[model samples]
Structures are given as C-alpha cells and as structure tokens.
Target chain A: MKIWCDRANNQRVAWHCRSHPETAESNAYAEVFQLQRSFIGTSPVHVPTVADIQVVTRRPADERPAVILLELPNRHLGCQTYPYDDLVQISRLCRAANIRLHLDGARLWEIQPFYNRPFADLARLFDSVYVSLYKGLRGTVGCVLASSDAAFMAEAALWQRRLGGWMVTSYPVLIDCERAFNLNIGTFERKWRKMCAVAAAIVQATKDFTTSDGRPIVYFTPEVPTCCQVHTHIRGVTRERLAAARDEVERDLGLSVFPWTLPSPFMHELDPDWVLVNGDPLAVQGMDQYFEWSITDKNVDIPDAVFAQGWRAIVTVLFA
Target chain B: MKIWCDRANNQRVAWHCRSHPETAESNAYAEVFQLQRSFIGTSPVHVPTVADIQVVTRRPADERPAVILLELPNRHLGCQTYPYDDLVQISRLCRAANIRLHLDGARLWEIQPFYNRPFADLARLFDSVYVSLYKGLRGTVGCVLASSDAAFMAEAALWQRRLGGWMVTSYPVLIDCERAFNLNIGTFERKWRKMCAVAAAIVQATKDFTTSDGRPIVYFTPEVPTCCQVHTHIRGVTRERLAAARDEVERDLGLSVFPWTLPSPFMHELDPDWVLVNGDPLAVQGMDQYFEWSITDKNVDIPDAVFAQGWRAIVTVLFA
Candidate 1:
C-alpha cells in the first residue's frame, strides 16, 4: 500500500512554514506518515490529510486506481473543510479515470457551513457517500451510505448486512438525529466565526505567558490563504485536564471538538490546513486581555487592550 | 416461486371454487404466483406449509424458486411465534440447502414471552429474521433484519448499500425502538390470561348478544388460538371507541395491549379463539363486570360472575 503527503514549503523558513514556536514541522510530517503506514492495509485507510489523498489521486499517473476516498482535512475544531476547488477537480479526474469515488463524510454535515455549499450538490458528485448519523447529525448510533439506487442497491445492503449494521430493528436513533440536525445545525457557521475570533485573541494574550510545564501557551492560527498553524506544547498535561477540555468544548459548541491532544498533530486523520482555535473560546478571550494589560503596563508597543476587548466581544457574539 | 401457506389447503380449494376472500393472503398469493411464473420466470407451486423450504431447494425439478414463504398459523394478534419444535426443524432444512430463510416474524417479540427464549438464540436459526419494532415492542416506527455479522459484512451490506435504505440515518429510530424494546416488553402472557378469563365469563353470559361486529365470541380455541379469542363484531368500527376499550383495559389491568382485527371468520384470522391480552392485566378484571352486566341480563350467570369476581380480586391484587 502506498501513501502520499504534501512536501510543501515549511512556514518559519518560507511563507508556508507552520508558524509555531516549538516542535519543527518536519518532525510532524514524519510522525504522521509513519502512523498512517501502520494501517495502510486496513479496510479504512489511515489518512492524516484529505488533501494528501487528493493530491495522490490527482497525481496524473497512468496506473489504474481501485477506490478513491473523500476524507476530512484536520480533525480539529474550526477545522475548515476540504478544499472545494480541489474536490470538484478530483471528481472530474476520477470520472475521467473511470474510478469509484467514495466519500467518508463523517463530518459532512458540519462541513457544509464551512465550505458554503449545499449537501445535495456535493452529494451528486460522488458515486457513493458514507455519512454517520452519530457524528454531525448527533445520533447515538447508526450511519447512512447513499448513492444511485441501482449501484448503491448492488453493494451497500450487502455490506451493511455483512457488517452487522442491518440488525438494528428500529431507528429511534435516526429520529433523534433528525431533530438535532433540523433544529441545531443552522447556527454552526456563526459558531465557527466565534471560535476563530476567540482563538486569535488567546494567542495574542499568551504571546509570552508560560504554562505550569514551562512551555509557551499554544493557540490556533487561522491558516487563511497562504499558511496554516498549530500550537506547540502537547505533553505534561493531566488526563483530567484533557477530559475537561474536551467536555467543555463539546458542551459549549454543542458538537465534538477533537485535536484535543494527539500523539502527533498530523496523524489519524488527513488534516486540512486549519485555522487552529482552542476549544476554550472564553479562556482564550481572557488570555488575550491579560496579555494586553501586561504588555502595556511594561511600556511595550503592543496593541492596546481596548482593541483586544473589542476583538474578543466580536468573537463571542459571532459564536453566540 | 413455491409459496408455503398455512391455509393453502383451504386457499386452493377456495380459488378452485372461485370464492377466495379479499384478504391479502389469497390475493397476494395468486399475484405472487403470477409474478413468479412471468416476471420472476418460476412456475407458481403450492406447499401445505413452509415448515421447510429445504425440499424445493434440494430437489429442484425445473424452475428456480421465487420466494418460499409460509402462511404461518396465526394467533391473530398478528403473531405466530411457535416453539423450537417447528423452528429447529425448519432451520436444519435451511442450513443444508442454499435457500434463504426469511422470517415473517412481524411480532417476533411476542413469541419471546410465551416460550421464553433469548432473542438472539431464536434469530440464529434463520438466514434473515425480519422483526417489526412496533408490533409487540410499541415502537413508533422501524423494523430490524437480524443475521450473522459475517453475512452482514459480506452479503447484506451490498444489498443495503445498493437500496435506498442506505440514505436513512438510523440513530433516532433505534432510540425509540430500543426504548420501547427495553421498557414496554413483558407482562404479555399475564395480561393474556386475564383477558382469556374475562372472555370466558363473557362468552358464558352473553350467548345471545352480538358484539359490535356480528362475530360470535369464543375463549381459547384450537383453531383461532389464544391471541384472537377477543375477536368481536366491531372489526371495522371507529378507532375512537376501539381506543376507549383499550384505555378501559389499561385502566383495569395496568398493562399495555395490542388490538388486531381481521375481516371474517372464514378468513381464519378472524376466527374467535383467544382474547389478545397484551395490554395492562388488571384493566380487564376491573372492566369485565361492566361488560358482563351491560351485555347480559343482570340476573343471569350468578355463579360465573361470582367466580370472575374472585379471579379479579386475586389477579388485580397480585398485579397491584
């Protein structure tokens, strides 16, 4: 089994270098590629970046491909969706190559608000798309795989029957999921904005603050156009704190917020270049204020507290 | 396609005489046979019962079998959960042949209380057991297809994936189904006994009184069996009054109930056999005197009424 990843320019050196304080980007790359090769032969391919897989599928090589996947980019909060421009291009390529495109849309519902596209239009492009009711739809259990009636009828029933998913006698989970999907999904985009703003404030506040472990406070970088950034200092954390953070993030946003603390940033899921934001949006805002106050008292030429406060307020309202 | 029907003996005779009932049973069978010979390219053949489909699969004389289904003997609560005596024999035949066994176990859960067997143990005997979550479980909607995980992973998934069944997210449905499955099951037989006793008293008292429908009443009979003993003349009566009876039954018994009405006695499912006592148990005792007094002369059947009164005192107190 072969794997592929982007060997793009690093940020600290060139414009594209991942702009973080510690743990170089090269090491991140190596760790991710290594973990994925572990599950290379598994049915569900271990991918760290959707773009990485996309890059390979669109490699313009002459070899016949068996199956192609539409996977998520970084599995993180406020993680922007896969590149739509690249996605349509990939679909065209797969169609040209006569290859099957299967979508791993576990986060597909959450993705639409970020990408600014309708699910129906996106759904039409793939030969088959797999979406989990338990994920973005907020079901306790179950998943859906959709495609053309004939082609889908040929394989999915056979697989679900074989996979032990068909034994579920009734669909209470689906009904609950439907309510959550219909009622709560509309506000996701607004919430995403709030998270991004709060994350920006956090990094600005903690510009020089260190944690108990003596590492600089890490914040998410909204990798807008040219660059992407993830925070440093992953270790020296207690299990309690980690769990608390996950719970807080999920509760506040009413959705799961992963990238809580990964062994390596780029492992497990093929991550999209994300505008990393801390799950603790309120705490980030607080940190921003602290930085503004401390720096100004020292007579530093940093941005003013009023500006910081205004930024945080905007972020809070956006998420709210 | 060979079809196994319980009343196929009567059905064949009726069809030959040009006098079959409009029930789905007779019409559905004839249509199914037509489709088998034409659309499905298999000649329609009749079997006495589908206790075994192994016969046709092994001794395929000419045509491929269409669908081997039996007219399962109805208790007319829409359930026919027989003991292992029949099922185990059927399963052995299924295992030796390539034929798929599809259980029309719509109220399969009803069988659980009568014979007392684990659901999985019974499910293991069939290739695919179709269980409706609503019938006995009181779920709002949904059915389950239970089978081997290997079969699910191998064959069933392909069919589910291909069918539009893949489009549905299932968590909500499962939630409701499992909630009903966990909470609403049990006490069926206990309530059933109460209903049978009450019916026995009524049948003994009101020989001249016709039910809302014209059908005559019987306690538990061998042909109509236990579940259909409550058959009344009001089969097509408004659900408003039918529901009132349901509420009354619940009020007296404190258990839930299921109501199944059939077209006619000649239809067999309508044959008065047993009162379906699926609802609250005490409710019937509380309401039995009201029924006995209202339908018969108040002076009649003093001994039977006194006996019923004694039964009500014990059962309701025990239930309480």
Candidate 2:
C-alpha cells in the first residue's frame, strides 16, 4: 500500500479517501510517509461521492491530489458498498481529473456474492488493487497487487527487494495460498447465506431489549448486511460488562458469542466534527459496544438457532 | 544493513570500508540509499590498516565519516581475517574518532574454529553486528542483527514495520532456523577439519599442471584452509571450458566438482588502480576462473580422495 501510494502521488503531496476507522491508512500516511495531517482529504461515508472528489481535488495544479483510495464494502461501515453506478461515476471522475484510483480489496472475496461481478471486472475500475491471500482465502500469509501499468509493477518489485520482502523460500506460503484459494473461493456465497440467516435470528431475539435511556439494546449497522460481515452494536452495555457477559456465557453455554468488543469508535475519529453525529446514537450516548461479526466455512455448520441462543444468553447476563 | 547504516551515519554522509568484490555494499550504498559515488572511501585490503582509517577519517568535523563497515574474513579475499591485534587497534582508532563501527559477520560462524573466541567476544568489537542465520548455520533463511543500543534497535523495529518485514506468521521459519542452528553450529570445527583435508589433497593433485602461459593451473587463494570455505582459482581455464569440463566429469564419474565458476573479478573493481595488482597473478593475466568452495555436513561424508579425483579429471578434460 505504501509503495502504491508513494508511486501514485508522484511529487504531488495530497491524497483523498473516505473517512473510516481503519488503522492501516493512518499508519501509512502519518507514520510511514510522514505526510502532514492535512494531506488526506476525506469524505464521511462508505463510498465518496463525485462531489467529494471535486472538493478534494479543487486546488491549484501543483496542490491537487494525485490519487484517491477506496475500500470495497468498507468494513467499518458494516460491509456496506457503493451502488455499482456510484462507483462507476467515481472512477470516471478520477480518470477525468488525472488522479489515480486504488482499491483496498482485503475483504473482496467476502463481498463477491453481493456484487455478483467477476473479480477482474471490479479490479478494472481502479488503477491498482490490493488483495490479501490470508483474509478470506485462509492462506498462511501474503498479498497480491494487480495493475495494468508495467512501470508501476516494476517499481513495486524494486521496493519489494528494498523492503526484504523477498524471502529465501516462500514455497510453503505459496502452496498454502493455492490450496486455500482453490478450496474456499467458491464457498463464499454459501457462507454469506448462512451469515444472513444467523444475523436475522439474532436480531429477532434481541429486538425487544433496550438501554436504560430507551434506545434499542441490539442493532446492526446497515440493518441488512451487504456481505458476510456486519458490525453488531449493543447499546447500554459497557465494554467491561460485555466482556464479563461474554466469558460467563462461554463458560456456562459452551458457546463463544463474539471474540471481543470495544466501545464504539467516536465519530470525530472518522470525521472532523467536534460534536457527535446524531445518526450514530450509540457513539453520542457513550454506552455502546460493537464487534465485527464475520462468517466463513468454519462457522457455517452451526445452526442459526444456536447463534440466537448464544446472543440471548449474553444479553441476559448483561442486563442482569 | 540499510537501517543500521542510515541510523549510524546520522547527518554526516561519508563512510569508509575496505574495498572488496562483494555486491552487497554497492547495492546498499548506491541502490538503496542513493549515496554519492565519493561517499564511500575505500582501503584496498582485506583488513584496513590504522593508516587507512586515518586517511579516510581525516576530514573537517562536518565531513568526517560517521561509520566504518568491516566484513569478517573478507570472502572476496579468500576468507582471510584480520589478526586479532590489528582488529583491536582499529577498534581503538574508531573509538577515539567517535565513529560507529559495524561488522558484516555473514561468515562469522565458519570462522569461529580459527578465532577460537566466543561469538559474544567477537561481536563486542563493533557497535553493530550482522550475522546470517542461513549461511554457515544452514537455516532455511533469515539473518540477525545485534546492537547494544536500545534506541537503535527501536528504530530498526519501526523500519521493520514500515518495510512490511513483520509477517503475519513466522513460526515455520523460526523453527527451521532453530533446528538447523542446533544441528550445524557445533559441527563447524569438524567440517573445517574435513575441508582442510580436501584442500590439501586438491593442492597436491594440481601442483604439476600449468597454464599455456606457464602460470600454475590451480591454487587455493590462501594456500591453506582458514575455515570451511576457500576461494579455489584455476589459472588457465576460461569459464566456458571449466563449465564443459564440469559437465563431462559429473556425467562420467558422477562427481560434481564445483557448482559453477566465474571469470576472476578484475582487481580494478575492488581497487581504483587501472593497472592490475602484481600480487594477483591470475587477474593480471585475465584467464583465471574461481568459485567459492564451502564445506558442510552434506559434502563432508564424501571421501577427500573423491574431491582430488574429480578436480584431476576436470583439469585433464580442460587441457585435452
């Protein structure tokens, strides 16, 4: 990602991307490149609008942003993706402005069922696309970057050598990536179906519960997930209480409800607003916890009723 | 190596090291850091003398070299190491000059039998030391850099993160490294003993052969084994003739004499002198081929006589 951004920016300093709570972007911009805090112009949405690109790019020729980065089905926003038309418009805008478009497709495999588009078709919309072999493919570790530009890839190869990414022996990782990709790529649609059924069951079970301040106790960002992952939020529960409930439920019912939870990320972290946005009621009230719930073949065999039962057990212990 | 050099050099640009045929130094200085051609002051010897250090370091306060890099048992110079007393004197000189010193100890483990000193004692002579876990230790792959300065290591850690050296998983490589180290570390002295025997036999077998120009056809660079590796030079053989002879001998005797050979590196590549050094007769004549012959457990089991026989056959084929 750093290599791509550095090459794409090409002496122009600024870049634009949607505002989100991913640590990777901050790590690359502020830590690696040491770019100024103001160098990243952001829009507060899963997908940036055409107008947002214009606003970010409206600068003197020397100051204009060199690239725009977009995450497919932004995970922080409950795996919600741009409508295909919106993406086409954004791609066209960047092309017209001579700005490069990059895609962070770490979760691309999970979202494939929702888009029903070939990977190549989706990748064609961006100047460069990065995909992880370990994320949905269940490989040991590694990633691939695709681009039509030969010069860009050649530069990436040089950076790879400079960074010591060329290992003496990588056959183990490569073999595992191939095996997992072959075994798992075709199973995402099935996993998505199972995830939707589980989400629906849990929603029905927790619908009647509410916080002391009268907000619903349990809800999901986007309400209906567009992919196999969703952000599940539980209001009126402190992080400590949720942890304790999680442990008790696991011990008593032999079910691990969620791996972990954290207080909802503040809206200000994703945007410049000093005041919390009313749209994110949990962050405004300050007593909500959330975790990313994702599905894969490992969890697809568990009955949907079991998911509802596990959440019910945790909620009972939390409200007790 | 890049991270250490960058940190040790601080603001001052100039640095000094003995001139040698290793490509690693050039890659780091010219390719990675983009240092100027004049930044590296060279001494044309395996071990830079105290006078050489004075010459390289005598500069304005702002222009003095920030660090000196030394390769143990300079591989290009037949693995000939500096005498311990000379090394002690050089260490004192660098200390008085307030210049950091680094050791490229890629072959440190192989030389341990000759030095008969603890690894820690040898490493203590420099501010930073780099040892290859793969080379003499026979690990799958990886290297370790040692430094007493905590801040320097912390900076390396940050560089590691920025360069993506921190892999998602590394247990397999770590386990293989440990296994190889344990299996091979204690066997160096035994391997050294075997290599010395092999070298002696080859020396006796090729003593009678002569080049068309009457130079000795075969000679060991150091004329005796210092460690498990030696630079074996064939004075009359061109690279192509040696390669063809190698194939014929391997096919007929089922003995692989040397993996590959290269035309002897020009003396001018290591030193600025346009005229070849009188001491290196093979380079002066321009018809020599050489290969680094390293001994390990795998080759130790083969009879020493087999190595002599293989070389005799290859030489006979070359002369015919």
Candidate 3:
C-alpha cells in the first residue's frame, strides 16, 4: 500500500488535507492505507480522479492488489467527471490484475451529460458501484450500491449494518430521493447545457471589471468549467458584501447565488484567499469564505431578469 | 469462536438467524470473526453478558484479548437493561484484563428509568459507548459515541468516513434529534411509570377469554414484561381486523397500538407467529394482526375512556 501511494506524483496528498486544518501537509502523503488501517488517504485527481490501476498492478506477482476504488465525479475537484476512456483503461487494468474495482460515484448524476451513457452501462465497468442519493440527487439522506455479485452485495449489506448505516426507518430519505430523482433526473442534461450557457454569459458580462489592485473582479477558477459547477471568486468583494447582496438577489429575483461561506465546507473545495466576514452559518458562525455554485434541474431556468438583478446587486455591493 | 458459540446452547443462534430465512439454524454457531475479518453473531445472554476475564486471560501469557464488546439492554430478550452490579463487575474485569470494553447502548435511553442513574455514569463503565438517537429518543436518524480515549475516538471517526457514515449534511438529523431530546428526555421517567401502569391495566383487563384451542386471546409473551415495551399476541384475529381496530382506537381513543409489522424489522425483534400482512406502514397502509405498544411520555397519559374504548375495539374485533 505504501509503495503504491509513493508512486503517485509529489503533489499527491490526501484529499482531506484540503479542508481539515489539523491535517498537516507532510502527513498527507497519498498512502492507500496507513498503519492505523483507518486513515486511508484519497488520491489527488480532478473531480473524476480516474486511476490507471495498471500503474499499481505492474508490481511483482507476490504483491498483487486487492481492490481498486474510483470516484466517478470526485466531489473535491468541482465535481469533475471521468470520461469513458479513463474508466475503460482502469477497468482493463483491474481485470488484468484480478483486483476488484469499486466505483464511488457519489455525483454520478451530474456525469450523465458528460458521458451520454446509461447509469447501468457505466456501472458495469466496476465489480461494485456506490451511487449517492444526496449529492446533486437532492435526497434527504441515502445511497445505493449495485453489482452483479449477489454474495458480495449481501456482504456489503452486512457491513452496512455493522457500520450503523442500517437505519431503522429510511423511508423518509428513500421517498425523498425517489421524488427528487423523478422530478430532476429526466432533464439534467438540458439543465447542464443551460447552466453552462448562463455561466458563459455571466463571465462575458463581468470580464471587463477590475479590482483596485487590477485583478479581474469576477474570476473563474477554471477558465471554462467541464460540468454544471464552477468555482468563482469576486476579487473586490468581502464575504459580508456578497452575503448582504445574496438576500437582496433572492428577494428581488427569486434566485439564490452562492454565499461565500457554507455551514458544511467539507462538501466543497478549500480556497485560502477568501475570509469569512460575519453571521453564524453553523453552530457558531465564523470560518473562511469561498464561492461555489452549480447549475442543476432546479435552477437551470432562472429568468434573465433574475440573473441581471443578482449580478447588479453583487456589483452594487462591491463597487457602490 | 466456534467453541464459545457451541457452549451457548442450540437455541442460542445468531440474533439474525431468527429473521433471515437463508441463515440455517445449524450454521448459527457464534464465530467471533470470519476469515474475511468481519465480526458476526451477538451474545445469547441478556443485558450485561459478562465473560470472566480469567477465562480468556488465563490462556497463554502471550495471549491477551484486545476488546470486550457488550450490548446494554439486549434487544432480543425484551430490552433487558443491565444492573449496576453487572456493569461494575464487567468494568473491573475489563480493566484487570487490560482489554477495552465498548458498549452498544442503542436503547440506552430505555435503561435510564430502570437503573435510576445518570447516562454519563453508565457510560463510564465502558471504554467507548454508542447510543442511538432514533430508538427510544425518536430522532430522524443519528447516534452518539462517547469515549475518553481521544486516539481511539479519532480512529473511530476515520472509520465512520470510510464506511460512508460521514454525511455531507447531518444537521437535518442533528436538529431533529435535538428537538426530540428536548421534548422527551426531561419527563421520560414520569412517562415511563405512567406507561407501566397503563400496560398493567390493559393486561388485567384482557387476561381472560381463551381461543378455540384454549390459548388466551390477549396474551403477553413474557407473561409480565420487563420494560415499557411488551410484545402482545391477539390470538385468532386476522391482520386486517387488527389494522382496522388499530385505526378505530386511534380515532376514538387517541391512543395507538402497534401494528403487526414494521418497515424495518431488523431494529425490532422477531416474532415468528405473525406474518407481514400488507403495505408499508412507514409510507402507506399498515399491516399485521399482532399488537405491541410502549408506555412512553407521548401515550402515558391516555385517558381511561380511551383505554376502555381501545379494549372494547379489540374484544369486539376478536369475538364479534
């Protein structure tokens, strides 16, 4: 495990180190499993961090691998989804190595537009697949694991019980997920395209503005985002100004823009440039502020008027 | 592990075998861990099933047990809460043996009234304790683990993430649980006492009248229950009849009686005589002819008129 992790690039670090303040970067070496057995670190790839399992499987016959776990749309990297070629290569590598592959497709729903494939067809690449109902699926709380191996799934079920995931009453979550899926999944691709269009328009409209220091007032972390989600930064604005304008945007336009801070930051990336200004988002409100947002079925149809009002409010707060 | 399970008795099958039809009874020998490293089987004893540390500690000087796991208020035998003596003895044994003891206190709330002690004091007996929020606490879904060992807890926290138990947004559950704890925990003891009184009265009122085979119509499984919850058998009545009567009782008396089946029977006990009669009660229509109810704060003060009407409904449904 140590040997495999060491083979990765120097920049490779546990995905958690990005958000956990206590996690030292030195200790974030991309070890698959630590001595403690509990601290398995994540590989630093884009949202869909596809592993070419062959890289690890090339080891001596005596050191054959056990399992290869892949995240379809890695949540940490702006929900970046893997392409079919990456998945096919990994699948072939696992097949050759005779190691089981597990897909952590938490945000697989968002990947559909990029892949243009059925969920089941994509799932067939791995020995087992876990699709979350919450991330982008809008479930109250739930996930599902699918595989052709009945015995393996049964074992998974047992482990779920041992881990306290075997809920007494999960219907509330199940019902909510089902409803959300029915309402949202059908038009996700169209929504994604629409979102990309809106994002492009916003970028074009704001490209001319500059901060006092001359940096672009509105900047996209990735000049062109691959999916519906984009990490954004407003250079001249404090978190407080963005937050105040956030309420006004919703009031005037009935559309919500991303707040600089969220109660749960683990779900998003870590950006050090941002500073939390005011208000308690969680139990005690105070933490670094960052900006992120996604276009989904729910928000794909925001009217031009609303977007204009929201952008205007944000600009007014920062420049007025 | 096989030797220990074999000694427990033939009726001492794994708790799961009672419900899982695929699990053969003969194969139920309690193996502590399988070759794959998964732990299986529950102890056959009631609450506080203590193993004299001397038994294992006496083996070779090199052989030492790492941990002792105990389930307080054993679920199968009617949530039997452990006494203080049993807890003290187990704690002493664990300390002397140098083995960590963890308590599966899923129904710890139910133990408070019986032990007449504080929750923290009971928690101190074990190295770590897992208390459920959804069981008697009535939360949507959550649990709390208490331990003085920071490293061990940190390790456990890591395992929680690996097992997908580290949710993106658990505040929904946390907030609901907080609301429930505030509303319920304060007056739980008073409510419990009241419930016991009501249960006793119901038992007395419906004790007589035999079936065609001479079995009593309203029979308590244990004759007298050890806790607030009692498994009741309403003999010779169809599931539909009981379901109808259940609704009538709620409407006429504002008191609830348990339906024969629940959506998640794994959290509850196994009662083989009754079958899952119909729809998912958690989402839709209810089922099962068997009846069970608990004396809790919510229903402790059920009016005498309501109780009388409920009894009448049951008798009328069964005999009419």
i-RMS for every candidate (Å) is: 18.7, 4.0, 8.8
For candidate 3, give the lDDT.
0.55
Question: Which candidate leads the pack in DockQ?
Answer: 2
TM-score of each: 0.42, 0.88, 0.59
| TM-scores computed on chain B for all candidates | 0.52, 0.86, 0.66
Indicate the residue-level lDDT of B108 in model 3: 75
Badly placed stretches (over 4 Å) of model 2 are: A1-9, A13-22, A25-45, A266-286, B1-9, B12-47, B212-214, B266-286
How far out, in Å, is residue B86 in model 2?
2.7
Chain B alone, candidate 2, TM-score of 0.86
Per-residue error at A282 for model 2, in Å?
6.6
Tell me the deviation in Å of residue A263 in model 1: 4.9
Fnat values, candidates in order: 0.03, 0.28, 0.06
Error of 1 at B118 (Å): 12
lDDT of 1 at A210: 49
lDDT of each: 0.41, 0.72, 0.55
Is model 2 an incorrect, acceptable, medium or high docking prediction?
acceptable
Better of 2 and 3 by DockQ: 2
